[model samples]
Target: MKILIVGNGARESALGVKLQEDKRISKIFFAKGNATTDNIGQNYFESDIVSLRNLAIQENIDLTIVGPEAPLVDGIVDDFRKHDLKIFGATARCAKLEGSKAYSKKFMQTYNIKTAKAQVFEAYHDAIAYVKNHDYPLVIKASGLAGGKGVVVCEDVLEANATIHKFMIDRIYGDAGIQLVIEDFLEGYEVSIIAFSNGQKLFPCIPAKDYKKAGKGETGANTGGMGSAAPSPEWTAENQIDFEKNILEPTIFGLQEKNLNFRGFIFFGLMVTKNGCYLLEYNMRLGDPETQVLMALLENNLVDTIESCLNGDDVELKFSDKKAVCLVICSGGYPQNYETGFEIKGTDKVEHSTLLFAGASREAKRIVTSGGRVLSLVATGDSFDEARDKVYADALPIHFDYAYYRDDIGKF
Candidate 1:
C-alpha cells in the first residue's frame, strides 16, 4: 500500500518509521516533511490541503495519515474523502475539540465530562475583570489554535493582566486569542492518554507524561514539548478503570450523541490528582515528543492498527514491556525569538537511540536546524533509568548553534 503522511515534524518521522514495519506498505510519501523524514520517504515540501489532496490522487496513495492538527482543522480529511481518497484523521467539525478551547470546554460540560470549571470570554474587559476577582495561579488559555503556546499560568493579577493584554489586546497569537478560557487551577500530575477511535469503539495507547516548560524545574514559557516518557509512572490500573468509565466511554458516547463521526486519534490531556483524573484538554491527533517515545514502545504494526480502525474492526493496541524516553534538542530562545539554519553535527554518531527529526531541513549538502524544537533523541530499555541514561548519553554528541534541552526528563 502506498501511504501519504501530512505535516512536517518529528511525529511524522516517527509515524513513517513505524509504518515501515509493515512490509505490505510499498511506498510512503510525506507532504512538507522535515530533514529526517526526507530520508524515510519522499518529501513534497508542500502543505496546502487541496494541493496535498491532488498529490494523493496523482500518486494513487492508498492511505493518508495526518501528523498535525492544523491540516485536520483546515478540513484536510473532508477534502480527501470528497475525492474518494482514504485518510485517517478527524473531520473539521470534530477537530473543533482541539482547534477551539471554548468549543471543547463547552462540549465537555455538555457531555458531562470531568474537567476544570471555567468561564469563556470574548471581550478583554470581561476577561480582566474575571481575573481580578479570581485567585492567583489561574490557568488562562487561548480559544483557538496557538501551537501549544497559548496556555499560561498567571501567578497574580499583574501577570494575568499582562497575559490578557498579550493574548486579547496585543493579539500575540492573532485571532487564536480572540476568546479565552480562564479555569480554576487543578493541582496534580499531568498525563496524556491517546486513543484510536473509529466513531464507535476506542483503542488506547500507553499513557505518557510530557514536560511542557521550556526550562528545567518547570520554569519558563510552554513550548510544543521539551521531553517525555511512555507508560507514565503516575498512572495506575485503577486510574485506567476510572479513565475508561468516566473519561473515555463518555467521550466516545458524546461524539456519537453529537453525530460527530471522529475516525482518528483523540488525545486526552488529564490532570491526575488525589481526588481523581480530570480532563484538561483534547488533541485531535497524536502528541509530539510523546509520539517519539510511544512509537518506540509500540509492538504492533502501526499501519495495521490504523487500518483496523478505518475498517471498523476491533482494534487492539500493543506495547513492549519497556520504558521509552524522548529528549528534544531545541534552538535557544525557543517558544519566542530564535535563529535557524545552523549546521547540526554528531547525529550520525548517536548510539542506542532512535533519532526523529523536527524543525530541521536539508540545506545543500548538510542538515540544519530550521525551527525551535530541532529533533528528538529516543531510547527504550527495561526501565526509565536505563532509557534516560541511554537517551542523555546519545544526546551528548549532537550539537548545533545555541542548542539546548531540559536536563531532567523521566526523573519524576
Candidate 2:
C-alpha cells in the first residue's frame, strides 16, 4: 500500500520511519517533510492540501496520516473526504477542540470536566479589567492556536496587563490573540496524555512529561517543547484511571453528546495536583518531542493502528515496555529571536538511537537549522534513567551554531 503522511516536524519523521517499517507498505510519501524523513520515504510536494490530494490520487496512496494541527484546522480531512480519499485526522469541526480555546473551555464547562476557572474576552480593556479585578498569577491564553506559545502565566497585574497588550493590541501571535482566555493558574506536575479514538472507543498512550520552559530548572518562555520523557514517574495507574474517568471519558462523551464525530488523536494537557487532574489544554494532533519518544517505544505497526481507526475496526493498540526519552535541540534564541541556515555537524557519531529532524534541511549535503525547534534525539532503555542518559549521550554528537536544549528533563 502507498502511504502519504502530512506535516514536516519530528513527529512526522517518527511516523514516517514507523510506517516505513511495515512490510505491507510498498511506497511512502511525505508532504513538506524534513531531512530525516527523506531517509524513510519519498519526500513529495509541499503541504498544500490541494496539491497533496492530487498527488495522492495520481499515486493511488492508500492512507494519508496528518501529523500537525494546521492542515487539520484548515479542513484537509474534509477536503480529502470530498475526493473519497482515506485519511486519518479529525475534521475541521472536531478540530475546534484545539483551534479555539474559548470553545474548549465552554465544552468542558458544559460536560462538567475538571479544569481551571476561566473567562473569555474579545476587547482588550475588558480582559485587562477582569485580570485586575481577579488577583495575581493568571494564565493568559490566545483563544486561537499559537503553536503552544500563546499561553503566558502572569505573576502580577503588571505582567498580566503586559501580556494582554502583547497579545491583543500588539498582535504578538497574529490574529490568534485577537480574543483571549484568562484562566486561574493551577500549580502541579504537568503531564500529557495522547489518545487514539474512532468516535467510539478511546486508547490512551503512556503518559509523558513535557518540558515547556526554554531553560533549565523550568525557567524561561515556552517554546513548542524543549524535551519529553514517556511513562512519567508521577503518572501512576491510579492517576491514569482518574484521568480516564474525569477527563478523557467526559470529553469523548461530551463530543458525542454534541453529535461531533471526533476521530484521530486527542491530546490532554493535564496538571495533576493534590486536587487531582485538572485540564490545562487540548492539542488536536500528536505532541512533538513527546511523539519522538513515544514512537521510539512503539512495538506495533502505525499503519495498522491508523488503518484500524479509519476502518472503524475494534483494534487494540500496544506499545513496548521499554522507557523512552527525547530531547529537543533548538536554535539559540528560541521562543523569541533566532537565526537559521547555519550548517549543523556531529550527526554522524550518533549511534543506537534515532535523530528525527524537526526544523532542519540539507544544504549542499550538509544539515542546517531551519526553525526554532531544530531536531530531536530519541533513545529507549529498560528504565527512565537509562533512556535519559542514552538520549543525552546521543545528543552530544549533534551540534549546530546556537544549539540550545534543557539539561534537566525527567530529572524530577
Candidate 3:
C-alpha cells in the first residue's frame, strides 16, 4: 500500500525510514521532504499539505502520518477527515493541549493532574508585577507556539522581570507572547514519555530524556532541542508508576471526558521530583530529537502499529533492548539568527549511524543547510554511552560552515 507522511524534518526522515520497514508498505511519499528523505521516497513540494491532501485523495493513499505540530494544530487532521481520507494526528480541538499553555494547565487542574502551580496573565505590566511580587526562580512561559524557545527559567526577580519584558513588552515570541504562564519552578529530573492514542487506549513508547539547554553542561538559553537518549536513566520504576497513576491515566481520562476525539501521539513532559512526577507540559505530537531516538528503538512494524492504533485494534508496540542516542547538528547562532544555503560536506562518509536531515535540502546535486537544526545522527549500541559515542563519531563527517553540536549529550 502507498503511504504519505507529512513534514520535512529529521523526525519525518526517521519516520520514513521506519515506515518503509513495514512489509505491507510498497511505496512511501513525503510532503515537502528534506534531502535525507529524498533518498527514502518521493518529495512533494509544489504547494502545502492541502495539495498533499488532494494528492492523497487522487492516489488513494492508504495512510498519512503527520510529523509536525503546526499542521496538526492548524486542523489538517480535521480537513483530511472531511474528505474521508485517513490521516494520523490530533484535531484542532485536541491540539489546544500544546497550542496554549494556559489551556493545558487548566485541563490538568480540571483533571487533578499534578503540575506546576501557575497563573495565566494577558497584560504585560500585570505579569511583570506578579514576577516582582513572587520569589526568585520561576518558570515564565509564552502561552502559544514558539518552536520550543518561548519558555524561560528566571533565576531572580531581576532576570524574571527582564524575560517578562522580552516576551510581553518586546513581543519576542510574536503572537505567542500575548499571554504568559508564570508557575512555581520544581526541582527534578526531566523525562519525556511519548504515547500513541486512539482517543481511547494509550500505548506508551520507551521513555526518552531530552537535553533542552542550548550548550553543554545545561548552560545557555533553551533551543528546540540539542539531543536525547532513549530509556532515560532518570526514569525509575517508582516514578513510572506515579506517572501512570497521576499523569498518564488522568490525562487520557480527561481527553476522553472532553470528547476530544484525540488520535495520534502525545508527549508528556514530566519532572520526577522527591515528591512525585509533575506534568511539566503537554506536546500534542512527538518530540523532534525524541522521535529520532525512539524510531531507532522501535522494533515493530511502524505502519501496522500506527494503523492498528488508528483502527482501534488491540495493539502492543515492540521496542529493541539496545540503547539509542541521537545527536543534533545545528547551524551556528541557532535558536536565533543563522544563515542558510551553505553547502554541506561529510554526510556521505557517515556509515555507522542513521543520518536524518532536518534543516537541509539538496541544491544542484549538493546537500546544503536549510534550517536551524540541520541533521540528526542516531545510533544504537549495547549501552547508552556506546550509542552516544557512535553517534558523535558519525557526526564528525557531516560538516557545514557554521555547524555546532553539543559534546555532552547522554552524559550524566
Query: By lDDT, highest first, what's the ranking?
Result: 1, 3, 2
Compose the digit string of candidate 1's lDDT tens values, residues 42-121.
99977999789889989999999998999999999999999999999999999999999999999999988889999999
Please give the distance, in angstroms, between residue 53's alpha carbon in candidate 3 and its true position after superposition.
Answer: 1.7
lDDT of 1 at 88: 94
User: Compared with the true structure, what per-residue lDDT tens digits does model 2 show for residues 278-346?
Assistant: 998888889887888788877767878887777777667678888888888999999899999998899
TM-scores, all candidates, are 0.99, 0.98, 0.98
Q: On residues 1-412, what C-alpha lDDT tens digit does candidate 3 reach at each position?
A: 9999888888999999888777777888888899988888889885366787899998889998888888888888999999999988899999889999999999999999999899999998888889887876799999999999998989999899888888888899888988999999998889999999876878899899898998988889899889999989778889888999999989889988998866799999998889999999999898998999999998888877888888887678889899988899999999899999999999889888988998999998899999999999999999988998898889887788989999999777
Looking at model 3, which ten-residue stretch has the lowest summed lDDT?
44-53
Question: What lDDT, from 0 to 1, does candidate 1 have?
Answer: 0.91
Query: How much RMSD separates candidate 1 from the native structure?
Result: 0.9
| Clashes found in each candidate (C-alpha, N, C closer than 3 A) | 0, 0, 0
Superior by TM-score: candidate 1 or candidate 2: 1
Query: Highest TM-score: which candidate?
Result: 1
Residue 172 local lDDT, model 2: 87
Provide the overall lDDT of each model, using Cα atoms, as 2-decimal numbers. Answer: 0.91, 0.87, 0.89
Cα RMSD for candidates in order:
0.9, 1.1, 1.2
